[model samples]
Target chain A: MIVVLSGGVGGARFLQGVVQVVPQQQITVISNTGDDREFYGLHVSPDVDIVLYSLAGIVDAANGWGIRDDTYNTMQQLTRYGNEDWFLLGDRDLATHIHRTNLLRQGKTLSEVTDNLRIQLGLDLRVLPMSDQPIATHIQTPAGLLHFEEYLVKHRSADDVQDVVFVGASKAKPAPGVLDAIKQADAILIAPSNPIVSVGTILAVPGIHDALHEASGMVIAISPIVGGAPIKGPADKIMRGLGLEVSAIGVTRCYRDFLDVMIIDEQDAHLTREIEDLGIPVVVTDTIMRDDETKAALARTALQAAGLTI
Target chain B: MIVVLSGGVGGARFLQGVVQVVPQQQITVISNTGDDREFYGLHVSPDVDIVLYSLAGIVDAANGWGIRDDTYNTMQQLTRYGNEDWFLLGDRDLATHIHRTNLLRQGKTLSEVTDNLRIQLGLDLRVLPMSDQPIATHIQTPAGLLHFEEYLVKHRSADDVQDVVFVGASKAKPAPGVLDAIKQADAILIAPSNPIVSVGTILAVPGIHDALHEASGMVIAISPIVGGAPIKGPADKIMRGLGLEVSAIGVTRCYRDFLDVMIIDEQDAHLTREIEDLGIPVVVTDTIMRDDETKAALARTALQAAGLTI
Candidate 1:
């Protein structure tokens, strides 16, 4: 199994690329559920859904989230019913939430629901959450503690982050097969998702980090940060808030302990020496995934760096 | 306190009149939750939402359910996703399902979420579910068992009803305050809804019928059947399936145990003696709620019969 650790958006995009170049059945995605939140009583797993939709080839390319051509009529009516419209839930997206919620209410685990959804979407790949337990990522900002969605969606990630706390992570165990995916993997790829909130939040769960450290598979991470900026979202701003530089070197240090190979952008070729100085293999390529072809190319390049091109 | 036992459509219209006649806070609606179902995992309580929308004055006048001017864009997309679209769930309706499903996943009771919806919609009336548990009304047809929605919406009630069963009825407990609504009410008016599937299903829940039997309040029912046919839906057909007449007298017998008065349409005034023979008081009026004025007039008439018009 080729297990991939992912956040939302950028990570989902890279996973989509990986699925395109490789056999989907051979791939397994261990998604970060730390950003999960209960909105309007529905379990909204942004990263999990992003990876699912992206891998299913049904993600809205323009937004990098939500189903393609989905309507917002439901969200508009929700506002009329006096609901806060900070989180824009698309109508098609609502179906996924509804199905997941129903199964959960029936006492099924999140892992089971995730698997069923993948099957329903005709996906051959396995998409599992990091944990079935609720692990909420909370951003401690100057305004106060805010749910990750409130920070990312409602406030548009405008606040300065003082600290990031993953609630329930301490009590959370790795979901079934997550550790197995790590142990049996030929390679483990960490997607180019937001480092602090996505990848950092996943590592917050105790056993997941240890599993990565002990896994025999070659572990590689694609740089979400290019030269000194994220391709999308507030990763750059969040990095600065945490008193870290927004560069390939910063990304390398973040994954230094577990990372076997690091992939950076060709624009940041000058930083290769610094990245390699950390005693990790560094690969430089055009890491900006502008389209499906570019994403696939990036995926292929990252795999080659780990000596798994075949 | 004004207590209204309601279904959808006509029940919603009756509740609208009740809201206009009484102080909103004093009115409590014991809405049928037998129509509740998990369509793709969203908890959709059609009757409760209809009453809510009607009370909020946002109900679609044409369809008599969902929000006015709600689009079907989501429904159209659901088809693309290969979902069965026999039941019409508008985009606006999806929001309610999403919100309810999400809330339910977080361990909130159905009653609590419904109250929250009532508050959100600015409805001052207390809308209590008939039962908090999942008690679905299934019709055993020639084709086998079909859900209430499939029998009603999908097939348009064309199937020959061999028998009807309220699944989970034996296990269902009346929602909090449902029994209280019956006992404390000065009067109880059953709206002109499907006697079998709607009102019958609500009464099937344990403790509800017993409470009504012992209630001190004057129990009145507006006949859904008039002349030889139903005002709306296939109540007459269902009545026939139960080996009962498709007239006002048939409805009186169905509710005879606790029924104090039977309200019939002017067209069925001739059936008064036959109903009165059952020892239930009979009133003939324009029971067909053609407009808001007629509905309010019906509410006033029912209140006057119970000596609570003031």
Candidate 2:
């Protein structure tokens, strides 16, 4: 089985490629839940929903999040009701939040709710949240600490991030089957997602980092940074604010403790030597996924780097 | 002040007429809350929304409920997620539910939330739920007891209603200002609504019935039944199921205890003398309000019946 650590849009896009190379039944995704927050009292797991929508072929391809052909009628009406309209919630996309919230309130854990949703959406692969307990990614800025979504969406990530705090991470237990999936997997690939708030928050959870280190399979990571910049999102700004190098080498440093191989873009081949100096093998290739062919190729490369035949 | 007891669509239509005759500031609508139910964990008050949307001039006039031009994207997506699709929740109308649910979770009473929504919607008149406590109107059918919405919307009222049950009425207190509005009103008008579930549910509340009976103001009721049938909804069916006559006399009997005057449609003028025998004065008029002018005329007739000169 192949286990993937994923975040939002970029991660979802990467997973689409992984599915093309490997049968979905053999894959298990441990999705980032730090981006989860309550919008109008409905629990919204942004990264998890992106993965679900993308895999189910319902994701809005242009935005890489929310369902395609979704309407914003609910959000528009909510705005009319004087609700804060910073986070846009599309009408069709709201079904996931509403269903998940209802299930959670009924005493089902996030993993159980996700499993039910995946089955309902006709997905065979498993998707688990990093933890069952609420863990919010708060970015400390010069202004004040803002929830990850508020900083990324509401403020457009304009604030300079001084630090990132994973609230409740210390007490949060890995959701059921998350650590088990990592332990039993033939290989684990960390998707190209924001390292600070996405992959970083997952590692902050109590047993998740230990599971990655103790797993018997080769651990591979695809660098989110390409040519010293993130392909999407504010990974570059956040990495810089945290005083980390904004390169493939910086990504390697973040996962150096458990990472066995690092996949970097061909544009960052020059940094291979620095990445390898951290005792992680570096694979250089064209990682920019512009189409299905390229995405499939990138997934194959990451899998092969983890010692998978396919 | 003119306090109007209301249910859903028919009552909302009557309220539109009430507003045309009386200034909005002088109106207080006590809407039924027993039709309120949770859909995917979101509190949906169908009756309350109808009154609000109608008075704000944003109602879908064709349907008598929901906002104009509302979409059902959310309900469609929710059905895809394996949710029961019996109750139709429009996308734009979902905003009121989301906002109200969020505020209720934040410890605000239903009345407080209604006030906030009213102000946001630019409404001047006070719109109060019958009670702040949860009270669901259930129809005891031959098959089994079903929620009012289920009986009406889901099953299309196919089963014979043995009786109507207000689940929380005995213990539920009238929402703040409900009884006070009745006691302090210059006149009270019962809108043409479903007496069994809408206005009936409001009156079933603990103190609301007594307040109407004890209030010094004249109480007037416009028959929801015109000739021997309701203008809309399953009022006649439910009334017959509960063993009540499906005519103006049956409606007069429902409110006979507190009713000082009865307003019947021109079609029901033949029953006016029999209605007067119950010690209630009768007024005949063309109660089918097809336009604003007709609605204004109906409102004037009801007000004048309460000894108010238009």
Candidate 3:
């Protein structure tokens, strides 16, 4: 079985590749929940939905999140009612939050709700949330502690990030099957997701980091940084905010202890020996996933790196 | 001040006429909340919304409820996720529910939340819910006790109703200002709505019926029955199920206690004397409001009947 650690758009994009190389039923995804927030009082799991929409082949390819051709009629009306519409909830997208919120209010765990979504979406792959516990990834900014989305979406990430804190992760256990997926996987790939908040929050869950530390399979990571910057999102700003280098070297620093293989772009080839000096081997290739071909190629490389495809 | 007790579509249509004669700010609507139900976990106030949309001139005239031209993208997507979509929730209309639910969750009374909607919709009048307390009008059918919506909307009012019940009305207090509105009003108009579930549930609230009984205002009612049938909805079926006559006299029988005058359609003119025999004077007129002029004419007649206009 192949297990993937994911965040939002970037991870969803990389997952498009993973599903191409591996049979869907044999793969499992552990998604970040730190970015989950209530929009209009309905629970919205941004990262999880991104992965779900992407793998189900319904994600807006141009934007890389939300359903394709989704309508914003609800948001338009919400604005008319004087609600804050800065988060941009599409009408079709609102259904996901509604279903999730209803199930959660009915006392179902997040894991169970996610599985319910999986079955409903006709996806064969398993997608486990990082934890059932609510975790707010708060970005300490000049604007004060902003929820990650408020920092990225509402504020447009304009404020300088001062620090990042996973609010509830310290007490959170990994969601059911999360630890087991990592432990029994033939390959555990960390998708090209933001290291600081996305993957970082997942690792912060009490037993997850420890599980990876003793995993029987190889833990591979593809750096989100391409040519010294993220293809999308505020990864570079956040990495720099944490007083870390915004490069392949920095991503490795974040996951070095548990990582068996680190994949970097050809642009960061010179940093290979430097990354390897810490005893973690680095694989250099064209890691920027521009299309289906590039995404599949990257997935093939990650699998081959774990000796699953060789 | 003019106070009108209202239900859903029929009341909304009648209010269109009332607003033509009376300045919006001069009118107070006591809308029934017995039909309120949670659709997909969001609180949906059908009667309240019908009133809001109608007065705002955005109501779907054909359906007599919901905002005109509202999209159904949310409901479409919701059905895709396996949720029952029998009750149509237009995308724009959902914003009202979301906003209402959010405020209600934050501990705002339904009255306050409704006032918020009123102001947000740029309305000048007050639209008070029947009570701050929730009173579900359940239809006890051979099938079981069904939510008013489940009975009317989901089941298409197909089942034979054994009885109708206001589940929580016995303990429900009249909302703040409700008793005062009835006590101090110069005129009280009961819009054409279902007497059994709609107006019946309002009267069932503790103190409200008593307040109406002692009201100093000339309490007027427009019978929804015409030609021995209702203009819309299951009023005829439910009245028959309750073993009451489905005619103008039947409507007067339901409201004979507080009513000083009863307005019946020209088609039911023959029943006027029979209704007036109960000590309630009856006015016969064309009560089917087909257009703006007809609606205005009906409003003028009701006002003149209360000696409030020429």
TM-score of chain B of each: 0.98, 0.99, 0.98
lDDT of 2 by residue, B156-179 (tens): 988888889999899999999998
Error of 1 at A104 (Å): 3.0
Better of 2 and 3 by lDDT: 2
Clashing pairs in 2: none
**Predicted candidate 2 versus true structure: per-residue lDDT over A261-304, tens digit per residue:** 99999999999888888899999999998988998999999999
Off by over 4 Å in 2: none
Give the runs in model 1 whose Cα sits over 4 Å from its true position.
A142-144, A183-186, A204-217, A241-243, B17-27, B72-86, B101-113, B131-147, B159-187, B201-219, B257-260, B303-310
Worst 10 residues of 2 chain B by lDDT: B289-298
TM-score (chain A only) of candidate 3 = 0.98
Candidate with more favorable, higher DockQ: 2 or 3 = 2
True contacts kept of 1: 0.60
What does candidate 1's lDDT look like per residue over B119-210, in tens digits? 98887889999888999988889999989888999989999988889999999999999998889998888888888888998889899889
* Poorest stretch of ten by lDDT in candidate 3 chain A: A301-310
Best candidate (score: TM-score): 2
Model 1 DockQ class: acceptable
Alpha carbon RMSD to native, model 3: 1.3
